[model samples]
Target: MSESKPGFRPAMTWLHSWAGLVLGLLLMTIWWTGTLSVFDKEIDRWMQPETRIAAPEQRISADAIVERVLTERPDGTLSSLLIYLPEERVPFYEVHAEFENAESYRGRLHPGTGEELGDEVSLAASGFLYPMHYRLHSGAVGYIAVALATFMMMVLLVTGVVIHRKIFTDFFTFRANRKSRRSTLDLHNVTGTIFLPFHFLICLSGFAIFAGWYASIPLSFVQLADPENRAVELFYAADNDAYYSREAAGEPAEMLAMAPMVAQAETIWRDRYGVEAKADRIDVTHYGDANAVVEVRRHFPSNRTEAHRDSINFDGATGAVLTNFEASPLRKTRTWLEGFHQVRFDHWPIRWLYLVAGLSGCVLIGTGFLFWAASRRRKEAAQPFKVRLVDTIAVGSITGLVLATGAFLVVNRVLPLDAAALGIERAGLEVRCFFYVWLLTFVHAAIRKQRAWMEQCRAIAVLAVSAVALNWLTTGDHLLAAIGKDLWPIVGVDLSLLSTALIAALAAGRLRSKMRQVEEAAVATHRRDMGSPSGAAGTVANRAE
Candidate 1:
């Protein structure tokens, strides 16, 4: 019964095992960061102390807020402005404005008093962790790498299912007390079997976010530079002309008040959808000119699971209706998918489930890496370099990655506001700290060998506790105080940090105990081998009888 002549499923098993081993670390990195991103806003509030203000009983009018912005730029000519109104996750008014004579401006404003919230001193989870999940913090190269990883993930998942024919049984099975390799594979199977659909959906939607563009249009340079496609001409003719873009009349016309137009658009959306809805953003083209137009877009209920492109264009100066845009069903389906991928809509329960499932994904990948190494360890004993390389990678990728993230959070609270030295700003310094710590973990793993895992876990515990303590010391928002002030997001972050610390400490203790047992067993074997002259010469003759 030589494994039934190694059929299609066996071939798939080979593919699944090898692919999982090679890409497992990358998938774990993406999944872990993505899990953190589920609570990104909460993390942001914890990182940026000034933004911890509770939501006002009633927010100040948007018009009044805009007035303050205009006052700040009295000397410069305003060109365009984009406003993000106060929301549940971010309890502040954020704005981006361009000036004809000055640099572009971006800032947050108080929800009640309309004062500036000042520049964010830290990149936090929203700025760095979330982007890292999608792009790995590099520009085009990172984007392409993410796309390729996502595609490979799909292949891995499908082949994994094919290899594990008893999916339902596998979902129910767990053997934590078995031999190390067997237990590791059991954990991998349970997680992969149960979260198959979720992992597949996340990957598909993520790939679609950018892959759709490549699949459909906009090889921009190719479209424009190549004589064959005339892509630029086709783009503007369709995408631009649809907006009915027009030149500024130079001779100005009195602009209509924007508040009323926004209200009207909201009302139209409410009536059309039979639900209270609000516009996501507005784009004003040719501002203050006769040909000016305002596009109010993405009028959907805040917590809607999906998205649609619902927009209305208006003659900006005269307040006359221009073109009303509603997405085609095909377009609606795609936007819905993109929105689903983002997890932007507010739902605490679903978000928690996503976090749990995402962590399970990490476990699945991590265990798969472990099982591959363990299965090959005995067979590859002759090649200690290869075996050591695999172990180093396993330790560095699993505990090492977690250790780096702990350092990142700790450093965020440790760095001072607007701190700059040697040309790196506070935010840049934070990023450098993350990569530097991450790189150090690999070096530490290679040098320390098997002991690196336990050491790194202990370090993670220390860093996690330090992050929580520093957050309290710097922001004066200890967990109990945050709870009293109804700052649940900050409280959640604090509690999560403490939990991570506890988990890391427990893992470290277990690893220490395991190492001691292995050491004791080796000592007993060495003593027995030394007690017999035959054993010494036998070791050279395979210890043969």
Candidate 2:
């Protein structure tokens, strides 16, 4: 067959190669991180072992937390607050408050101290990574990137299906040791094809999660009439029906006590549905003011339904009931989707499945990166600066990101808990540690050449292992302790990190060895070929003679 001949279908050939070439790594990172994000809370629990406390009445009434918050920051707009009961795995009553002249909001919390947990506000760092994968943390830019990535993902999906006409037959095909473009193609197709359903749903749902922001631009006029002001704005609007007046606001209205309120809320939920609802949070607005509404929200679950679920209403000034909205159909649907998407409500089995899927997705993307590098390596030496720049970003951002995240966990353990005394907030320090490490990795990748890739991978392996060791150092229990206590989060997260480190170390070793072998073989071939007169030249000279 003529190598130059355009025998293979042009569109299919281009789609198969370029699609994998373009989106492989990013797709992997998004999938893996997203999977991890499902259990972001669990990971946090593993990292900050100190926060775990036995179920206690340590949960202050939502009303009390609100009252305390108002006393301190009178001008700050209270957005949301919740006090999780002791039985809940992650304990923290969070207060979302917005200060004047600030475009963004902040969450405040008090760490668990056997006694009264004070309202020492801090940013929600660990929980934020879950959203950051898709939402990206970059206000407008992040969402834009997600939206674009989703669109591209859709393109890859469509092209993938089209090019692989026999996708189903090849779905289970994975040939290890085959050395040809066809084998690479098969590997790419099998991974992409088998996970097509998962990829589609995750991508679509991820985009849908932010649908209000992205899809509401053309419908701004529609939102103008709607109070919530966005597409799929199904969350029950905060009931502002409470009677409020400047003069009457300070009236002596004894707000409903939280203990009874909790009992009553749980009773109402159970009696109404014959199910025990885990009330992780309650929101009370206008604490001392006449119009206080008690909003009860459920904790995060990996389950599809009841993820973003909450029920709320206005309680009269004198602790009398005023208004309430039971979970509606639309609200229920949103909750279900959000829950599955967030994996907030997932139990152990579902979480494991998600983890495996996430890892597979990461593999898909990582392979794509390798494919690109392998294909371009010979041409890379002659490529333009722009091409080289992109290559650098690919290497740095992909591998470097993993290391940076591990480093953040390490910093969290090392940084003194008394961060305030040192004029540094723990959350700020953590964020800086993550970003700075990533920044350094990027710079290091640009200057260090191929060696940087290996070095960084080795660093990632080391940091990951060190992070696992640090857990044992900081907390005596480690995986063994978690196993004894049957704490799956700690056990799973710790072991998973350790396993990842070993896998990474093995990969680095193999890559380094392979690179060394390739270099040696190339040198040997050069010496052997050039050691004697060229056979071709000698043959021509003899013919001329």
Candidate 3:
């Protein structure tokens, strides 16, 4: 106060602008990948053609699938087996088995035929892009980065509203016809202000999804004396007390058929919820032993907004219900937030809306990057390298990131099932394509400067269209074929790719026009300076492209 300190609004303004600028790149990556992950399962189906079949009217039995799994591998003493039953969205049986020797097996089977699918050659969205959203595929480090970014996002949203004197007005105040810097700011304000509540909630819910990580902090201290890292295990053990398990008796027992047990569990849930309910997964422990227990878990139902995994355990031999587990109140609250963030509930309209909101987050973050670069370029005009560097990063992160994703999809379609090099499988090769293409975009942006934006947009358009065409060529599932076969997931992905191509092409054309205008202006300024005795030092070219 004695020295005339800045007011609250001014402090918030500085915080908002600087914080956003500092972590904007990370935010954009998270937001874009998160947006794509809204339909990760759909993308999975589109990428893996063997999983694109329609749901069978008459389904195979859970008992039969289990029997087949055991028959396929008779050597190892069974440790545990998981059967993921088919649903409307994913119409296939998936099995994962673990033997006492630690050998594991995974396969996808046809719903009607129960025939195991060929080996999956690709690590589609569920494996890659979805994880990239929350973890960046870097494990603990990625988790921390995303957590920090999410926290900063919430802070930015608050500071942005405080600094924006006309926050509500900004919702309808986009001036698309204004000058470049002003319109960019306006667009940023509009997106940020329009989705203020949503942005806040999404960020907040993200924290809940990672609540376990936060819990590990205190639990780690609690387990300081232990040699093993059991903080997470302890956290779950205390919170998940309802789970029931029994040790193997070592006496061989013919386990009751799992089909009846599965039906009984579904019927109980359906009766309790007054709606259709089905077992999402069945987990078995100590198979072939008297104490073996079959646990059936139901997710995405039994409740809509909790992401609750309601489970019921049945005795191995008699198939009698052992424990109908229910989560604690605190657990339910966390799960509710998890469900809200995950959007895995059974609602079609809201699912599509989540997609729109997620993309809007991408737009909000991208526009913020643009606004900062544009405003800074004017004041830092003399530092050409600095301005160009900022422009290059902006171009590479926004358009280039998206272009890399398009290339990833295209490469997935182009690579043969047996594609491998230097011991890397086809899935690993596809990941390499994504990273290498992304790295090249940065180099390309630095070389092309202002022209990079338009050039990359064109590349994105080509890659997107090529992905769709290649999907048709390789799988013979064009838009029409998918529609005829009622393969809506494939159709949805194809249409989205075409839409992306169209949008990228349009953006390319606009950038080309803007580039022409900038060059023409620079030429005029140079001509004016050439005729003067003492030439003006600065030109439009020095300021911006």
Candidate 4:
């Protein structure tokens, strides 16, 4: 409500604090989910344990999987089909298809046998945390909101750097044992300063990936010059010509085998690029139509910079190469930026680094909220309504979300496989359980006030430990068993859950101790004031005299 000082730095500082405070919670949710999405596939394997097949020495037949999918579809009415080949990390072949009425089906098959893998009603990675990270599961509206948050994040990062007088010095400074407010501020500064470049580029690249939706000027101009519906078509166009459709040839024709087409694609990649690239995914469009096309996308090697760009399309009938989508210089730059942001090159070490950077951002935003609340606590004592609201929201958003996620994982294990007997889908029940727990945390926070942080932290600790316990109870796959079986993904997820519980427990203990210290300090101040010569009791006696 007050004007900032008449200086650039002061203006930036004001912007940094207020802007961050307004959107910091949403940013934290996005970052937290995005961090989890870095390991979405691993989590998928952990959740859908039936898909945990051992990789075979010889690759399975793609033709057999395609034939099986076609036979399994309802009356052979296929709109489009995608087959994700099995690899060492993901050892199950996956087939996904769309129907005429926008309905879709997905199934996993054993790499060695082409038999169905899991009947468990699982959303796997795509249905759970991955979608939340990108779109918050709210479709178009959520996408716009996430993009706006990313833009504001960029603004906050830039303004934070501009306002900090000793950015470089702060990067090397942290005083954890100092007073609460000072320690919180130092952490905020250190995290923001140390990971500034990574944070900046990740935000910028995320915005650039969806630039047409948010920054519409360039797209608007292109729309004016293009056909009326061409703008919409170009907006949804894929890298290849797979989306194009043609009328049925009026005669049903058996499709060509996919194994030869896959082998040919690999040969082409080796011959043209001089690299032994494997086709990770194969997409077939208009499967029975004469104009059907097959698109084979190469899996980028970890050493390659251009990861998502290499793909070859072929005529489904003749198995002849149709087109190889090669990136231009600008497109290549964009691809590299996205690849870096998404970390799809399959490097675990780099992925872990991304997770660390993302968590640091979370800490930075969290401490910023704490610093704001703590700095205003004394001044706003008389009318502490706003401070209390922020404190409640801070606890609800940060620790509450963690608690809710743990509940979700636990519910995933606890819910019956046929949850439909209760007229609720198992996957939907898991999601509902998450929201219910999260909403309850806000209610608890309002009721408990300042104690909510400790309460929620303790709740999170309990829920996290319970999640791991439930996994063991339901699957009989404890960390030790998972490790013995060489199921690193499950082992990692179980260990991570236990580690989270430990951290939450420690945090709860720290908060309890701090609360005691604060109570003692307040009592000491009160006793000293009451015993003073001109204190409340002394003033009353003097007045009576």
**Global lDDT of each candidate:** 0.80, 0.61, 0.84, 0.77
On residues 1-545, what C-alpha lDDT tens digit does candidate 1 reach at each position? 32476687778889888888788778878888988998898889888888999888877766787678889988766667677777888889888877778567788999899999888788989899999998899987777777778888899889888887678766788988766677788898999888999999989888767754454444665656675776555755543333556677887776677767778888887888788777766677766678877777763346688766677888888898788766667666767777777777778899889888999988988988887887667666567688678878888889988988898888888888868878999988988898899889989989987678889999999998898889889888888899899999988888888898899899889878876766665556668777675434333212110
Q: Which stretches of candidate 2 lie over 4 Å from their true place?
A: 1-29, 57-87, 95-128, 180-186, 219-250, 271-274, 299-308, 327-331, 378-387, 419-424, 484-487, 531-545
Could you say which candidate leads in TM-score? 3
lDDT of 4 at 101: 69
The model with the greatest lDDT is 3
- lDDT at 291 for candidate 2? 61
Report the poorest 10 consecutive residues by lDDT, candidate 1: 536-545
RMSD of 2: 7.2
Off by over 4 Å in 1: 1-6, 216-225, 228-244, 299-301, 531-545
TM-score of each: 0.92, 0.78, 0.94, 0.89
Q: Could you tell me the TM-score of candidate 1?
A: 0.92
Model 3 C-alpha lDDT per residue in residues 1-545, reported as the tens digit of each score? 21255588888878887888888888998999888888888999988888888788799898888778778888877778888988767778999988989999899988898888789988898898989999999998999999999999999998887778776656799787777777888888888887788889999999998876777767777678664766667667876665778888989898899988888988888887777777889899988888899999986662376687679999988888999977778878877888888877667788888888888888888888888888777778778798788887888889989999999999999988899998999999998999999989999999987788899999999999999999999999999999999888888999999999999999899888887776677667768777652233345444342
Q: In terms of TM-score, which candidate is stronger, 3 or 4? A: 3
The reply for model 4, stretches above 4 Å from the true place, is 1-6, 71-79, 98-104, 215-247, 299-306, 524-545
lDDT of 1: 0.80
RMSD of 1: 3.8
lDDT of 4 by residue, 1-545 (tens): 22344577878888888888888678878888888877787778777768655676665698888667767775657768898887656788888988766778788888877888867576755577878877888988889889889989999988888877787767788999987788889999999999999999999888766665664545667677874757556665633333334455555556788888888877877786676667889888887667778888864545555555667777777777778766667766777777777776667788779889988988988898888777666556555578678777788778988888888887777777778546878887888778899889888888887788898999888988887888888888888888887888888788888888999999999988877766665556557787563344323212211
State candidate 4's TM-score. 0.89
Q: Which 10 residues in a row give candidate 3 its minimum summed lDDT?
A: 533-542
